[model samples]
Target chain A: MSVNVIEAGGLGKRYGGTWALRDCSLAIPAGHVAALVGPNGAGKSTLLNLAAGLAEPSAGGVTVLGGRPAGSRAAADGIAFVAQDTPLYKNLPVADMLHLTRNLNRRFDQAYAQGRLAELGIPLKRKAGKLSGGQQAQLALTLALARRPRLLLLDEPVAMLDPVARHDFMAAVLTAMADDGVSVVLSSHALAELERVADYLVLLSRGRVQVAGEVEDLLASHRMLTGPAADAGRYAERPVVHLQRGEAQAHLLVRATPHDPVPPGWEAHPVGLEELALAYLREPGAGALPGPARGRSTQTSEVTR
Target chain B: MDIDKEIRTEGRPGGGDGETAPAGRTGAGSPVEFRLDAASGVPTYLQLVHQVEHALRLGYLKPGDQLPKVRDVVAALAINPNTVLKAYKELETKGLTAGRPGQGTFIQATLSQVTLPELAGLRRSLLGWLASAEAAGLDEDGMVALFSSALRDFFNRRGGSAGGRGTAGGETEGVA
Candidate 1:
C-alpha cells in the first residue's frame, strides 16, 4: 500500500512574533527522493524539523509515515535525520561513532555501516573532528543508513562539502535508497544538484509551499508564456504563478492544463525545474492573488526586464 | 537482429566513444552504453530517452543491446533509481526497449535505417546546401532557423493536403 512519508496540514511554526513556517500543506510520497528547496530562512529547515520531531508545530500538525513525529519511541525509531551541519561527536573516532549508533539504534546494521565506511576509504581510527568535511558527511550518511530507518530527512548535508564530496555523498544516498527502499526528504538550495538526484520536488518560499509534486508532473503542467505586455485578466481562468514584464514583452509561468491552448500571439515554452522554482521564489507578496487587470501597473518591479 | 549484426559489422569497438558509453557491463554481443547530461534544460529521463534514440539512429545500440542497470545508472550519475526506471519505461512505451525480469533492459526494435548510397547522396546535397546558405550570409542560427522553418512548412503542407478536406475553409493552421 502507498503511504506518504511525510504529510503536513496547515503546518506552521513560529518563534516569538516571527513565523518561520506558515500555512504549509504537503504530502511527500514514499520511496521517492523528495527535494525540499527554498532560499535562506524560507522555512525549509523548520518544515524538516517538524517532520523529524525536532520541533513542534505552533499550529496544525505533521505526520511522518502516518504517525506523529517524535510522539512515540516507535515513531522516532522510523526516522533518521542528518542535520545541515551533520553534527557528530567530534572527538570520537569514526569507528566509535559507528559503535555508538549500533548501540543506540535498535535496528542498526553493523556490517552495512562498517562496509560503507571501508568502501569510502575512511579510516576507522581517525577522529570525527579530524576528518575532512566530505569524510564527515559520508560518515553521517553511513550512520543514518546503518539505522535502516524507513524515512531519512537530510537538511543540506552536502551544502558545505566540495563538489566531489557532494557527488560521493549523493551517490551513497542513492545506493542506500536502491538497496533499502528508504524514503528521503533532502532539503537544499542547490537546484542543479537536486535536479539530478530528486524525482519529487517541494518548493517552499517565505514559509509557504509555492509548489509541490512529482518533478515530471510539475514540469509537464507548468509553461513559460512570452508575449506582448497586457492585463492578466485575459488569462484569469489559468493559475498564473508569476509574471515578469520586459520592455515590450511579458513572460508568465502558469500552471496550465494539458489541452489548454496558449493564447494567440504568446509563445509557450516548457520550463525546467530550476526555472519553475526560481519563478515562484522570485514572485512578490508570498501567496498573493494573481495580478489585477491594470496592464503595466500590475507588473512586478522586482524582475528587471 | 539484422540491425544487431550490422552494428557488429561496423567495426565499432566494444564501447563507443567514452562520453556516450555507460560505465556498465555490455551485453553478451551488443555493446550499448548510456550517459546523462544534468546541466541540459531537458528533463533527465527525456535526456536518457533521446540518448538511446540517438544511439540507435547511429547504429551504436541495436535490438539485442542491453541498457545499463538501474543501480549502475543511479550510482554513476548520482540520480534517483526511479528516474532511470522512468526513462526505461518510456523507452518501453515507445517500443524501443524492454526489460527482462532479472536481466537489464534490452533494445526491442531497431531504428529505421537508410541505404548507404542514398545517405551518401543526401549528405553530399546537404553539404552543398550548407555551403550555399553560408555564401548567402546565413549564420549557423539563421541556417538552422531557415531549414527548420522549411521543414515545418513542408510537413504542414502535406498534413493540410491530407486532412484539409474535412476542416473549416479559410482557417489557418498553427505552427507547432
Candidate 2:
C-alpha cells in the first residue's frame, strides 16, 4: 500500500484546560485532494496545525508524509502549511517576499515564482501589505507552491475572498496539482466549493473526528429515507445519523448501502457530499466512523492510482 | 500550457501556479470549452463527462480531436485537476477517448447523434409549440414550469402507453 499523507492515532490538542481536538484519528492517503471541514472551533485548525508540525500534540500522536514524525526534517521538507492568515513581511516588496521565502526554505523556485507573479500582473515592487486581501492570499499560496511541497496544507485559505477571488485562488491550486502532483489538505467551512475538488473528506466536530473517508464511499454508505413521522422511531435498529421530523413525515440519514432494503413506505435516495457532511455535522452523537486505524487500512488503495 | 494566457486575463495580478508557459504550441484550436452549473446539482466531473459527450454528439468533437488539457480546464473553471482526470478516465473507460503518450487526450470514437434533417424537424416542431406557448401569455417562467411538469408527468407515466401523451398536453393548459 502507498503512504498515507497523514496518519493520526488518538491525536488530541489542548489549549490550557479546554481540549481543542481530542481523540482524533484519520488517514489521508497520498495523491487525493483532501478537505478538512468543520464548524468554527471544531478543531479543524487544530488538526491541521498538528499535521503541519506547528503545534505539539497535547496527547496521542500525529504523523505526516507517510509516518514521518510531524516535526521531523523529512516531514517538514515535504509539507507546506498556509495558515488562516498567511503570514508575510508586510513591508517587503513582492519581489523581496520571493527572495525572503527563497532564503528561508531549503528549496524555492525563484523563476517559477517570478514568472507567475508577472503573469498575474502583480508588480514586483509593491509591498505585500499594499496588495488586496485576495492578492495577498494568492501571493502566499504561490510562495508555498514555489517550495513544491509534496503535501500542501491550507487552513481556511479562502474564507475572506470574494467569489471571483476564491475561484481564482482555487484555480491556481488545482493547476498546481495537475502540474506538480502535489497532494493537498485544505481546511474550510465553505461547503459548496469543496464539492468540486475534495475527493477525500475528514470532518471534525467539537474537538473530535466525526467522519473520515473518501467522499464517494462516505456518500454511498449513507442514504436519506423519507417516510411517515410515526414510523421513524421503529427503525431504531438501523443506524440513522440524523433524523428530521416534519409535519407528518420524517427524513433519516441512515448508514446503509443502495442495496439495503428500504422498509415499506420509506423512499431511499442517494446522498450528496454536502448533504452527508451536513447531516453528520448536525448530529454529533451519530458517528459513521469505524475504529480509525482499521477503518482506514482497508481503504488505503482508494487514493493512490 | 493554455493556463498562462487565461490567468493573465483575470485582471487580478498573477500568482504562481508553477505551470510553465510552454511556447510554440502547434495543436489546432480546441473545439469545446467547458462550463459548470452550480445549481444543477450534477457533480463537476460528471458535468465534464456530459459536456464531452455533448460535444461529440453535436459533431463539435470528432475522432482525433483533442480535449482541453487538465491544466487549462483547471485554470478556466477553477475546479480540481483530479475532477478533470476522472472525467477523462471515464471517457477512456467507455472507449470514447484515448490518451497518447506525451500528447493530450483524443477522441477515439463518435457518439450517435441526430442527423441535420431530424434536428431541423425537431427544431421546427419545438418552435411551433413555443410560439403557441408565448401566444397563450405564458412567459418564460410559466413555460418552464409547464414544460417541467409535463416532462415530469411524461416520465412518471413511462412504461405505460401514449395514454400519458394526452394528459401531458392537457396539463400544459393549466399553466396558461
**DockQ of predictions, in order shown:** 0.33, 0.31
Residue B157 in candidate 1 has what lDDT? 77
- Which lDDT tens digits does candidate 2 get at residues B126-157? 89999999999999999989999988778777
RMSD of 1: 9.2
C-alpha lDDT (0 to 100) for residue A289 of candidate 1: 33
DockQ of 2: 0.31
iRMS of every model, one decimal?
Answer: 10.4, 6.7
Point out the worst 10-residue segment of candidate 2 chain A by lDDT.
Answer: A296-305
- State how far residue A283 of model 1 sits from its true place (Å): 2.2
Which has the greatest lDDT?
2
Q: After superposition, how far is residue A51 of candidate 2 from its true place, in Å?
A: 1.5
